[model samples]
Target chain A: MKGWIYQLKSVRKDKFCIMSFFLPVLVAILLNFAGSIDLSSLGELQFVLTAGDLTSETTEWLARYGTVMICQTEEELISEINDPSTNLIGIEKDGKGIKTILSGDEWAILQQAAGTLPLLYEQRESSAQVGVQILSRPDILAGYQHIFAAMTLVVAMFMGCTFNAMNIISEKEEGVVFINEILPMSPKEYLIQKIGIGFVFGCLSALITAAICFRLPFARAAVMLALLVLSAFVSSLIGLFIGRFSNGLMIGVVYIKLVMIVFMAVPMISYLAGVENRILTFLSYLIPSSATLEGIMDLANGGTAMAGKDTVILAVHGIVWFLLYLLLAGRGKKQA
Target chain B: MWNHNKGNRDPARTNHRLTGKSCKTRSIWKSLRSLLQKDFRMMRSGKFFAVALGSLLLYTLFIHFAYVRFMDMEIYQVYLYDPAGTQRNVSPLVHPVASLEEMDRILHKDANSVGIHVTDGKPEVSLYTASKKLDRHRSDYALSLLHPGGKYTPETVGGNNLEQKNRRDITCELLFIEIVAVGFLGIASVLFKEKQMGVMRVHAILPLPKSLFLFSKIFLFLATDLVFAILLVLCNVGLSGTGKILPGLLIQTTILSLVMALTVFGCAMILKDFRQFSLAYLVIALFVTAPVFLSANTSIKMTWIRFHPFYHIYMGLKHAFFGIPVANPLYYLCAAGAVVLLFGIVKTAFCREMEKEG
Candidate 1:
């Protein structure tokens, strides 16, 4: 335990791993905050709908009044009326007869102050069209949050793995391996220290991300940390394997990077299409990013339930991959 | 005097010698052959051959056993609710549920059915709000039931039957899936192999153009993808259907294939390793692929989909499947331009990877 602490302290001194762990979390938080910026100006909607006609027709009309985004369907009327935006909002039709979808306090507000321009909305019905329609803010936000979280996880995995995988190989290049071999500490302890430090860094970064960017609940925070730990460990082992196999540190890192891209990244097609393929569904359960996404999505959407199965699967990934890495690295080290 | 000099000089020999060429044409051919052979061997070893063959079998099995079975379930159920018996022209297949309440119950029960609620006047089509784009469809469906006398036979734009429709949709989806997922990885794997073998750096010292290295990889992936696409279409869509639209489909495939391959190649070279690549991949899959897929396939509509590049690609694939060619030439122009732009970035990244310290 004491040795582990010392190892952790030494590993923290390595700036690359530390930076990789935190950079993605910071970027993700900043980007999410950027997206949260309220940029909906009243002038824009007026220009879009009125097209200079409103300005020309009613000079006294409050052009700066609030706008309502109306859907063409009749059902949209009910939804729009209930919307907070509809309070004190005006309406226009695509072709003719602009029935004010807004009523009550909003209607009174519109009637009292500004002259309303009721434009026609032309409804042309067709039979052969298919489209996607998101129902609410929660749904949209949930999707965006999942995507953002997954991206953050991916960036973190890449950065963490790249450095850790190259750690030993770079030491070998500088003949530090021989120096380390002369020390009282075993090589295994050194490798464990490195992996342990990487994992710790990954955990801290993830917690920070969840707290700052996601604003996750305790359950979600726990889930995210679990996923990050798994990812860190698995990635670190992969790095170890790469370090052992290649002639140079960069080559090993690059090679492992290529493998990760091909085997793990590409097969993850579900994220791209917004629909999970059956084959990929099975694989998603295996990947840390998948867990991160599912967990973070739950967090963002205010879900309280812990994903027990996912946690176990992630733990399994960490363990199995770690063992596989040790075996491969051990073989490569022996051969070298 | 020129003729005499040409005859004495042996024009072919002189031309060859001046070009610093020793059986240059032959060597070029030989080199190309060796390159192809080496690539073929490398590809086979990379497990792509097994993966491709396995994927083909798996997809085929799913299509036949699962997908086809599921698709055969039922067409959209039609409900007729004419209180005054105004819907006499209603087809026998139409469920004649009495009263508006009954019709509403049936629509709610099935949800997939298009209900013709002719309570008072002209028939009003009632279904849960699908989307603004699908509004026209719901209305047209209602109108069609009213005017049963007008045999409005759709004009056959291309020779595509129902089976062909299925084939095209499945083919486009499969191809899209393959390109978006598999081909992207395939390009990365090849680059990684070259990167690992230290041959990427070797290209820098070679007399052959650096662009050729990137071009060669892109060209090969494009050709492989095109061939896979053609086969997938032919096998599933039927020979007759594939024959009619193969040209257009191929055009779409080439564009998607090249674009995806270049994107993946650029990603692989620019990112540090597969871990980083995976992160980038996850981001791409989430932001790019997820949005495009959802916007294109499901009823879940993103108002911002119009701005998404992949959404256009997914739609383009769907359009290709339906045999309705994207009539706008500008779409193709844009697609081509995107491919070129992606290619340029990939090339730059590839060069950078080669130059990076070992």
Candidate 2:
């Protein structure tokens, strides 16, 4: 307890501590704001298209959705001319039918529009009303925020591990480890202190991220804070385990990069959690980020933040890591 | 001992024979050879090479066995609620719920799913709308399922099948991410090591162009990235598809590799410690990732993506994977210019750090 003040003071002046806490939250806000706008609802897209001897009927067909400008060559696309990097939309009049230089969502939309073309050709005489009603009303922002929050949490945890590991390495390099070893503090006490600081940091970051990014109620926010604390503990275990065995400064970080990808990325894809592949679905439980994200989603959707399956899996992850880190730290002390 | 060491050097004789300076190319190669050896030793000590090899193997295996099959998933789940069995002809893809409550529960759980509510013997669309376009699509999908033989035709856009398209798109994205994120970490890790060992102080006194130090690390990372690309493309896109795209892929990969490597190198030198460096990841990751992924892939398009530098680079790589490499000279020029600019910044920071330590 007495040594914690010094630890707090050191953390206060660290540049990484300040920046790491703020940057990801800023990104979270940015992503939430960007994800706010509905591009699909935006009225009319000006399409610059080119075709060989384009029919007036085709041009008229596209104008219902947006004003279509036709150029003789692909280079003459109005949009493409303004921006050198713009995708050129071209239509080729083929023997079979018509083909457009577009794919994916654009291709599908064009097809749907083309389907309406014949309808328009037939309904040229009647004034028909067309409209759409969104029935289900899914919270789009919540999902985006959840996914973005999950990604930000991954980055934050990775940062936590790297910073925690480097702190120990720096102490060892400065001969402070020897001094600390001789103090009345037990190895467990020392480990607890480090993990405790990490837990606090983890909690604060989650608070800041949630407060800025997601509009969670107090109860849900506290649950999220608890989950982040545990996640940060798991992250600290990664740092200490790697730090204890590392020959020098960067080795632990090198290993953490791989760990980050494995622990962080696999979970973010979400659907991979449902894959029939047992190993992949199984890995989601073993890695803390996977369960953590699920917990966040639960809280976002008004369910219990940490449910049975994820709670058990993450607890196991945390416990196993804690014990392994203790073993590694003990072995490292004995070797030294 | 000092007198004996002085006699061994015999600088007067050496200076006379060498005219005090060797030619450019030979000296450059000789210096590079030694610098590369030292950098390789540093990488070996840090296990960067072994870790990279292990990562390559892991990513390749995941792609071939797991990711390829896993990624070919249902686009979006469509839920159906027909109180009177009005949707008796529901497509196999649609999940039929017994009640409206059940449908609402599933939609809340899976926000991406589209739901169909049947009232008065006619289908009404229900979905958590992601975008106006996506909402319209989901509505269309439900309508299409209810009536498959509609006048609206959905023609397949690209030459590739749905599976191939998924493979190519995701493969391109993962490869870009691996290089940018992992490559950034790799360079900074090596730089962090040298900073830890105070190797920069020694280099400060060495008689060579300082750029070689930066060059050695970049070259090593570049080689590693190229190998990673080959293995990734082969494992995911297959060998035949790889041959067609390798040239454009390599060019774009090199551009992104250098851009990210130099950026991190600059950051590692400027930062005082590894912890400080790690804290910057959120900023770096957000800058490189958010705009790139959101604008390129998602329905929520930020108009400013056109101005974001990573947007162009990401699209270029994606195009290369699909056999349409970026042809604009301006794009290449911007990429080259960015690398050179970042290199210059890293060099300035490196020299300052060396001086500070000295």
Candidate 3:
């Protein structure tokens, strides 16, 4: 509706901007899905269990997992499993862990299937004075979404800011900004319009990713959207600040990368969080992206309230950078 | 180090008698010294040096103070729903809730946690399953907390304690990412500056070898990463643990650094602008490294991960951090082969870039 929209429509015509917005989100989703695929599909395999008297339930579990056969002696189990009719895996009860013997086209699948035997055994032989009950756990999709959100938010926001800054910086590099400097429009308004589109694009990326990948409550999504808006603003302003030093695309690339790594690192390292990671956790809140990630994490974990600290940090990061950009880019000076 | 390269020619003195006779330095050393100085100046002028120093301090500080402690803490929160007094003698770590409704509410809030529903005196695991394999593992863990123990016993296999092992692991992972992402970006950004300035074309006509330009940047990045690795290990892995593994760690770092720098150098030479390079960065950092992390660290297995070059390098680095150097000659040979291949590719690209019209 504002001048920014008109400017954005024209820039959106550029193939580069469109691709930059779309590709990372696509890749993040693809990889997230790829990581969730079942690798234990042993596909047409015969598994033989020998040496110990396994409970029927254990045998049933093994049967459900693979094509399982049972035999008495080691030699018998080996012969049956190794027959041409079977892509073979022979798992015998070892001291505490199962000893898996396999060699086939599906050898890796057998190994993976066998690896789960420990925990399965642990559950079957669970010793207790009392029964345990259930509460809840994260849906596998949400588990993957947590990562997808971070990846998309970081990639889109960083690239969006970089592209936004690169646009203004490239215009200056080409001596086009000088022509616009003398126009009647105020610098603040023009700067806002240019950076605003970039901020909006960043929010779109964050929103599209969260909406598509994550299943958050409406209210939680609203909170996440607000966080995304602030993050985009902070990111764009920082991009503008870095682009101010653009001798060409290369210098801007360097500075943008330096900032992006720091931005990305906070959330990344914060994944290793605990009481001991307290300082690291606090440090993550200091970066806008990491703080946003913390908010999304909270939301993903079923948190109802906004992470107050993240709200404050996002507000602070957005305002400070915007003011800084105003001071730097607001003057409309180009580096000679 | 090799005597194959000759000494530098003496600079012609206008007044030889007044200027004392010029001494000759080895050609490679002379070219390398000037090339490194120029590269260092370029690095300082750009934000690369400052950013690198800042990164080193920030990463080291985070690792020393935050990561180790974080890794030591328990991984998953186990929530127990016992409406009918079914779960007695439940593990203290399992948070007991009054009703299934309350358990559902808490689990809805914390998906990362495991939830166990105790109903009718039987414990039933309730949670969103990520995958069949992962689900079984989580189910086993939650059930074990109710009545804990396996028919089989778990024996500690490695000498390093949990904390030490975690330190090496996280440290190795971070170092690998830093080299691949940050260090790779460093050479490309610096070279982009040279290409923009039309200096590559100028260097083409100069007495300096063309290979020197690329080598200088690679050496600088290599040195910085080596230093970062040293500090990272010292701060994160503890000073005492550094003795046996330093040599092995450095070797891995060098191998990785060369592979990454050469790959990026070739990219920078070929790509039209940094904007395009960012796209490649996304593919490499997100798609390439993401799956590698999944396959190598997490339970997720990709059938093709072993074929991926970074997987081998990651394993090599991981093994080195644990004080077991990757002894396979083939690994080194492949790394060396990759560097040579990339350098040749990058050289051709650089030459083409130099020949292009401004």
> DockQ of every model listed?
0.05, 0.27, 0.15
Each model's TM-score, in the order given?
0.54, 0.77, 0.69
Error of 3 at B353 (Å): 3.0
Task: Give lDDT: candidate 1, residue B44.
Answer: 71
TM-scores of chain A in all candidate models: 0.62, 0.74, 0.67
Q: Model 2, range A1-336, lDDT digits (tens) per residue?
A: 877887888888886776665666776677577556544433233445676555776666445444466677755553342332232234445443454444332323343444443434344333122234565454465354466666676566555676677778778778887888888987888987776665667556656776776677777776776677777778877777766766556566666666776776667665334455777678667777888777777777677735445666777898998887778778877997
Model 1 lDDT per residue over B70-159, tens place: 442233567777778866766554687768788777766554467776655556667654333233333344445444432222112223
Docking class of 1: incorrect
Q: Which of candidates 2 and 3 is the stronger one according to TM-score?
A: 2
Quantify all predictions' global Cα lDDT against the true fold: 0.58, 0.69, 0.69
TM-score of chain A of 2: 0.74
Candidate 2 chain B lDDT trough over 10 residues, lowest sum: B147-156
Candidate 3 clashing pairs?
A127-B147, A133-B116, A133-B117, A133-B118, A134-B116, A134-B117, A134-B118, A138-B111, A301-B109, A302-B109
- Candidates 1 and 3 compared by DockQ, better number: 3
The regions of model 2 sitting more than 4 angstroms off are A28-137, A140-142, A150-160, A172-175, A217-222, A225-239, A245-247, A271-283, A305-336, B1-25, B73-158, B351-358
Candidate 3 residues A1-336, lDDT tens each? Answer: 457677777677766677787775775576456545644442233467774656666666556444567788867775554332244567666565455555332333344444445655554655233333333344445444465556566677776687777887788887977877776777678877778777877778767776666777788777777777888888888777776677766566656766777787667666533224676566666678877777767777778465556767899988877777777754545542
DockQ class, candidate 2: acceptable
Candidate 2 accuracy as lDDT: 0.69
Which candidate ranks first by DockQ, i.e. highest? 2
- Output the better candidate (1/2) by TM-score: 2
